[model samples]
Target: MTTHYLLNKLRQENPLVHSITNQVVSNDVANSLLAIGASPMMAMAPEEMEEVTKFAKAVVLNIGTLTTEILEAMLIVGKAANKKGVPVILDPVGVGATQFRQEAVSMLLKEVTIQLITGNAGEMAYLAGIDWSSKGVDAGEGKASGREIAERVARRYQTVAAVSGKEDFVSDGRMTIGILNGDPMLTRVTGTGCMLSGICGAYLAVGGKPVLESTVEACTAYGVAAEIAVENKEVNGPGSFRASLIDALYNLSEQTIRDKENIKRYHVNKSEEGTNE
Candidate 1:
């Protein structure tokens, strides 16, 4: 029941998403949106991005694999998205890995107002201007709590921030949520994080009170799909995990989110711990 409530809203709306993403997962990102009932538009041409973003519900910028041209497109699109009051999601993939990537993300931030920022602990810490020990694209093996990282970034960016780890933590600098229904196998796949950002774009299009709740709903749906995928994998590896994950998203029902949903959230000012807190 929970799945249909959100999915139906998204499908019925057929929100258009503008993405300036990495080449590595651009196709996968586009496919994920279609599976979840959203329309995807890949607009990377620097000249057309501004025009394309004007009509989109939201814009997503990712730096998984960077290029100067793509960076230019991102800034242009971001500015247009901001001008139209459309939501923007920034995903800094492997942000701490190099000066080039960090500089690129910094440039975009200076030019546009991002609505939601989602990344692993390491990427988020780096974007928040903290020196987090990281290895490549994956989040640092260190035990930096997702909640701590998300809160710091959200407050710093003045936007909703999400840090995904064993358990995902989402906050808008004031309210926080911890989602714990995903499986470790989710980490074995590529583009899952990227897809989550795209999912967020879809929810943002639906327009909820405060917008942050729309983001939380998207993350909950992604986590629930991961859990269901793991159950259906039956001891399979990442390949099977990927297929099952898509199936779970396509088959998600409202009853599952209402009954089996494991998402927990609370206002930050309340001084709570965990989702219930």
Candidate 2:
């Protein structure tokens, strides 16, 4: 299926997304999902995790502000979603900053079957067991390229991995697709990456394409929205850009995605590991 076809299906289905994300960007995450025609349920109570997972078409687990209670809720919700055959998307925010965060990610990966993982280059590098210099939540300098990290992470976790940066790359242990569509202003806004994770969950919930295609679609759509948001003359800075971004998502069209998306496909061969763009 085509990327626009999956996007149109997501809008038509309006799937429910259960997000166990940090408090800092919960509002943005919810609003972004709603803007893309998905119902967002920011429910974190461990007591009701199973029930909420039962009703959710997709689950997003973000570890931006990690806590014991929040971690517990994520585990419960992730496992429940797994049992129901629902897609689970993980955003390991600031994972390399602390040992606790690293351990938390390891635990979650051990117990939960994540369908897709969305994070910056540094985060994906850490998950792939590569040596990367991470500065808090930002994607610090890394020796390995984003494509390498994404492919390694996908192979290690047995799922789709997406690394977002100036250019976005999504891999499924076989092929990696690079998307060049977003703007630099996206980095100025808080929770933009988190919001993209929520969007990935929504696309996966629609379930018309493979996990890799769904993730690429999510990244492309999000990047296109950011590019459109920054094109408005009214957007001067982060505040205006953030507001305009939501409007862009709300008004996003399949034709726009088709016309503006800049994507390149690369085949990943185990014997000869090199990018063939």
Q: List the candidates' TM-scores in order.
A: 0.92, 0.97
Question: How far out, in Å, is residue 169 in model 1?
Answer: 0.7
Candidate lDDT values, in order: 0.82, 0.92
Tens-place lDDT per residue, model 2, 1-277, is 2457877888898999999887899999999999999999998889999999878999999999989999999999999999999999999999999999999999999999999999999999999889999899999998999998999888888889999999899998898999999999999998999999999999999997899998989999999999999999999999999999999999999999999989999998876343222
- The residue pairs found clashing in candidate 2 are none
Model 1: runs farther than 4 Å from truth? 1-4, 233-235, 266-277
- True-vs-predicted CA distance for residue 1, candidate 1, Å: 13
Top candidate, metric lDDT? 2
Per-model clash counts, in order, read 4, 0
Give the TM-score (vs. native) of candidate 1: 0.92
Q: How would you encode candidate 1's per-residue C-alpha lDDT over 64-159 as one tens digit per residue?
A: 988999898888888888888999999999988999998888887778899899999899988766667889888885555788788878877778
